[model samples]
Target: MFDFIRNHKRLMLILLALLIVPGLGLVGVQGFRGFFDNGANVAEVSGSKITRQEYDALLKEQLERMREMFGGAVNTAAVDTPVLRQILLDSLIQQRILADEAKRQRLSASDEAVRKTILEIPALGALRKSDGSIDTEKYHDLLAKQGMTPEQFDARVRRSLAIAQIGDSIEASALAPKSSAAQLAQLSMQQREMRELVLHPLDYSAEVKPTEEQLKQYYDTHQKEFETPETATISYAILSAEILAASITPSEEELKKAYQDNLATYQTAKQVRASHILIATPKADTVASAKAKAEALLAQLRKQPGQFAEMARNESQDPGSAARGGDLGYFAAGMMVKPFEEAAFKLKPNEISGLVQSDFGYHIIKVTEIKPAQTRPLSEVKQTLLSDLKKQQATQRFAAAADQFSNLVYEQTNSLTPAAEKFNLVVQTATVARQAMPAPTAVPALANPQFLAAVFESETLKGKHNTAAIEVGDNTLIAAHVTAHKPASVLPFETVKQGVQQKVTLLQAAELTRKAGEEKLASLQQSKSTAGFSPVIKLSRAGARGLTPAAVSAIFKADAEQLPQYVSAILDGGVYAIYRVESLSPLPELEPQRLTALQQQLAQLTGQLELNAYLASLRARSKVKIYATENAAASE
Candidate 1:
């Protein structure tokens, strides 16, 4: 929620979108304790409390939007961190600060504007009357359901519009100098032609061999590299929602009752399997001519029912289905346009309709089949109904079962047997190697980082208390006790002697390669010509020579004042390469499109700078109060 504050240009823009501004993100309400009652608010803007309820709703909405933006690839459990929470809180606070400042500057939106904006919202405008005016009663009811009075909702809309108006004016006024565009283009497009000599670790490896003393010294200095990771064995009382749901049996009576209750949804509507012959309005012809052509085609279809498909193929303008005899398949009422629908529904099986006109032009339809409205019996939908019922019942039972699981585990402290017996759950056991070895994904219970920390904490490992129930996934909870812990220890010298020798040899080879590269660079700097180097060609700042990002960065960072510059850096696999800059070239001119892009980029930069400065000045002068921060709230 508060993440947008770092981006000053978009802060006000996003706030104006979701309101009272619903984009205002966080002030942790659940565990947060403050001077004010419940400490549910992060700040007060002109004495208006920004409640935790508002913060939570906005954050949740934004989080869902983010997941949606990523095509639902984001794992929700991994990213709900305190850092993100604080970022949201900051954004909310920033919005409040700006809103309060808007009030001070007498930025006001008229009531008419507020009303117009309100009516534009689908939730408010969906109940519009014939006069293109809002249904006042429904609008009031909508606000009531959202826990807001008319005045409160109205004032919020008015405030948001005013602030948005101010933001747009400020952004539009931002100017980018013409000279800056040319200069920026030059910096981004500069190219250097150079040739580099590459050296590999294998080249120096044959010359270097480590002595016994060197291997021993390397092993002792880098002892951490050889340390054996700690391992732990844990016992868990697993309360699985899936397992519980599968085991439970709902009586036949309950299943029947649920089926009956959902009977309305199983009722199918009246529909016809249809095919049409359409004479679409041609680009060169008028609608009247198209209708006349459709009438002539309909007359041919009426004379020979079997030739309807061939005639549709030869003359029908509805290309989507013309190849397949213009079959529109099965469609219920309300699926087709008014004139077309009225004509098609009045026909019986094997019956043909005359020319019917709609927005798509004229059509002649045939009723291939018709299905009257009917209710689906229990036999047809039993399995689906049973599955849905079982899930619903299991969800209801799990809530009560989870409370008992949490309580029994906490009350008994030393054992999981009582809770295991109560839920008919098994006390499962597993051994994990260190914190990083058995990845969190491998074990379902320890999927949460907090659970992993608790398992290794002094209380659970040494004090022998059961770790509190930690939520790892949707409808999943886990608690564990450390059965045994192996402390981390270093491997003895003899145990890793061969590995240590290999490390010492590589280290020596890498140093030799670096030294050789530096010498080569110095030699190249002295000689301006390509005496010993390979052919050098130009590579731009865009780096199109298959150069690694690191190599490109190194090249650009070199001192540009000197011609024929030289620099060397260690590459991947203990290799080294020396890059020599032969010459630098700048762009000739910025094209119209490039100039426009640069101008927009410059304008956005100036807007951000201006907005940030404005926010800073507002912060300095205002009585901005933060009752609680995301960090302080999360620590509890």
Candidate 2:
């Protein structure tokens, strides 16, 4: 057989090639076939697919952000919920859609724009040099920690900016009609003088009586409220950075190095609050003419310095600060143009500057307040540096032991004791449930959904074995051994009868209160009387006069065209109230500042609506399909 095979080797090779060619053709290419069958693609938008790897990466990034925002109080497990997963998946699809649209429309971000955006990120502030340029070495090192090259990060940011331009263009084109805004502002600012006659539930409680039949019915209907959740008595061990940090101590040299590396963060920049009168060289005026006008204003301000605000309001070309008496507010050294900043910083407090020329024109500046630069001494920041260094070392140590901790919990499945001893962790006991604990900072390891889900696994629960080690947070792993399990059950009706009776009494009292309040409203409507009403109080959206939102809404919705209009609302604690609408006082005219603010708010709302409609159109025209995964699926 060996001799025959050796002689027929070329023939066998030819036959194998013939068998594989058709399979490749049937699948349209083995590479693409493998990609589709990888079982990770979550959605297809336009012509591109969103893979599960992409979904999980984004989910992890969002989780890290939320963890940072709430510290350890944020539930890492809660972020994995189906609703959040769907939202994230939809976000990914929408981003893909927008990116595709941007590409189709040939929209792009310039290198300068991308650089400006990168420099503006607050996280990268430490990497900026004193000259306001990025430190190339530090920037590269920061990107290296995130496993990205500078080019890759730039490309990502450029793509994001291009997609953002689409929405920016749409928003800029949106215009809220002046009349509509005025009408809406009138409704928002309109105040009503109203008085209330409240029907207290406590007052009506004596008239209502609960019976045994009602208590039994209420208990049966709301049985879940009386039931105890399924809980497990478990012994768990935590391997956290804080635990590891306890054994580690940084030397003085390390602390000094860390402090030196982040020296910029320990210092504050000098700032000055100054007012300026700008005679802008608009198209109508030449630079010479604007400078002459500014010189005249400076001449006037020199004699009557206190009247500088009046001169700025009457003559300053800059509209933004003209209303505020040319007060440019407090700004740091780098905030203003080169010429203006130099002149402002050179002046002492209450000192005025001569004609300083810039692109805007010539400016007369007055320095009102100055805040000096401040730097913290090394000794004052030593403890913070020490704490940070300890955590850095501990995080490295935790990474080294995480796999070992995982292996120990799995290999010795019957108990968490082995893992606890190996990692020098304390095996603490607690009663945990399927849902998270109510207290924000109580038992985060047990509150972790992944850990809790593992604890509830049939094998782990039935065999009384340890759950697999789960990463609940950054540098935190947890494993648990179920000591005992109690299934969920409802308490007996007889035991909860008294509580049920209290609830029934409130329901009955609320009914009585509502009826009495409604009858009083009808009587007031016919009699047109303000008898038994409290003193009239002013009401608007901004000032609710201590009324519940529902009550306020009911009062505002009533017909105030006729005086003494009547309305009723049910307040909290089963208190009901009847309101008598006395008079409507429409704002005759919104103040200039408030009018401008209202217009801006209305424009923003209009822009958002237009953006939503634009996104909807894009979705309609594009072909988007979502694939179901084991986790969750976003709706099409």
Cα error, candidate 2, residue 182 (Å): 1.8
**Model 2 clashing-pair count:** 0
RMSD of each: 7.0, 15.6
Assess candidate 1 and give its lDDT.
0.74
TM-score of each: 0.72, 0.70
Candidate 1: residue 397 lDDT (0-100): 85
lDDT string, candidate 2, 478-544, tens digits: 8899999999999998888888888899899889988888888788889988888899888998888
* Highest lDDT scorer: 2
lDDT of 1 by residue, 506-537 (tens): 88998888888878777777875566667877
Best by TM-score: 1
Angstrom error of the Cα, residue 522, model 2: value is 1.6
Which portions of model 2 miss their true places by more than 4 Å?
1-38, 63-84, 115-134, 248-393, 625-635
lDDT of each: 0.74, 0.78
